[model samples]
Target: MVAYDGTDFSGFQVQPDQVTIQGEIEAALHRLTGETIQISGSGRTDAGVHARGQVFHFDTKSGIPLDKWRFVLNNQLPDSIVIRSVEEVSSEFHARFDVKVKEYRYCIDNGAVPDVFRHRYADHIRSPLDVEAMRQAARHLVGRHDFTSFCSAKTVVEDKVRTVYDVRVESEGQVIWVICRGNGFLYNMVRIIVGTLVEVGQGKRHPDELRTILLGRNRELAGKTAPAKGLTMWEVSYEE
Candidate 1:
């Protein structure tokens, strides 16, 4: 599956009575295939979290030819979601387990006032942010460590150690984009990281303080969780 704005939907997962993206997509798949199939996604994005290149997989006994899979699925799916491509692979291929890395991008609009058009897509900050300071702080996060401080308290994962491959911050006009690539992320991890970086940009926290936060491994010592609307899953990769 490709990415979506996810603003109009409840969330990525199917719920009892809510209009979720996954529920709609799976319903469409059932309409086309006449099979009650279960889809597995790389991650379960929150209600407002968006994605540009999300991936999912499902099994079918319909025996539809691989070349025609996209055509069939697209016809039944809504306009909000698009099936970019389809291919046949071994049944053992798991979308989440085979994923080698995931990348996310957070957008911040640094202007005196917010734009109505971008309200649903980017975060608007009234105060001026020090871009250089944020960039320096971002560098400190690009390494392997136990990121307990950056994650939300609701995360149930047993292991907190994760490797961050890269972090880049750039500004264009009033928009600042923070891009991060990692092996895996804990719940609300990227949003908290961005929140901390924003504090660093505002001179409320020092760049080196990230090390202390990580060492402390205490969620209370971290910055507040950034809004989910500004975060987008940029891409996902799997190893051969």
Candidate 2:
């Protein structure tokens, strides 16, 4: 498992002339084992997004013990990233393909005063949001559906069908958290969902309008994509 504050790096995937989570880990692996390695992550988070339970898998023939691998690898990586745990899994396990569920949490600072300390972690919204209305809007997004309207129009994937198992909104003091769990998600899907719900909370749209938007199947019908900093890949689950 791994956790990272991704504000400074690009996305998780490696790109030329860009710092990324995968690139840093691969570099550390090369320096520690003297062999070039590639690691596959459960998801490729967007820039400025954070992850608390990101998981990856890599093939290695190094002699280092599994228990020692965590400490040794952390010593070589930057403080922004941390190796939370190291374990040995079966050879048949594949990190990306074998994922069963993913959970994402988006934080909104709805207080009148923005939190400077959490500026890097949460998005600030000064306007009062109707949390119940947001919850109502979120309920419409639950279950399996074609989410073309909620994903980025630039996404090239032809199939937009995905199963959202749950979506709930709650408030804790000044922070409002939107939690979503699904079997899979399209590019910017969760962000767009939060945006649409925010519009509903602001009384700009009715809760029932989400169903119409989903049926419209047009990206333009959806609200703006929420900022990436407020989003976090909270957890990933796999079969036993």
- Candidate 2 C-alpha lDDT tens digits along 1-240: 999998998988999999999999999999999998999999999999999999999999999999999999999999999999988999999888999999999999998999888799898999999999998888889999999999999999999999999999999999999999999899999999999999999999999899999999999999989999999999999962
- Candidates' lDDT values, in order? 0.88, 0.94
lDDT of 1 by residue, 128-192 (tens): 99989998888878899999999998889989999999988889888899899999999999999
Q: After superposing candidate 2, which stretches have Cα over 4 Å from the reference?
A: none
Q: What TM-score number comes out for model 2?
A: 0.98
Task: State residue 149's C-alpha deviation in candidate 2, in Å.
Answer: 0.3
Q: Where does candidate 2 clash, by residue pair?
A: none
Separate clash counts for every candidate: 0, 0
Q: Supply the global lDDT for candidate 2.
A: 0.94
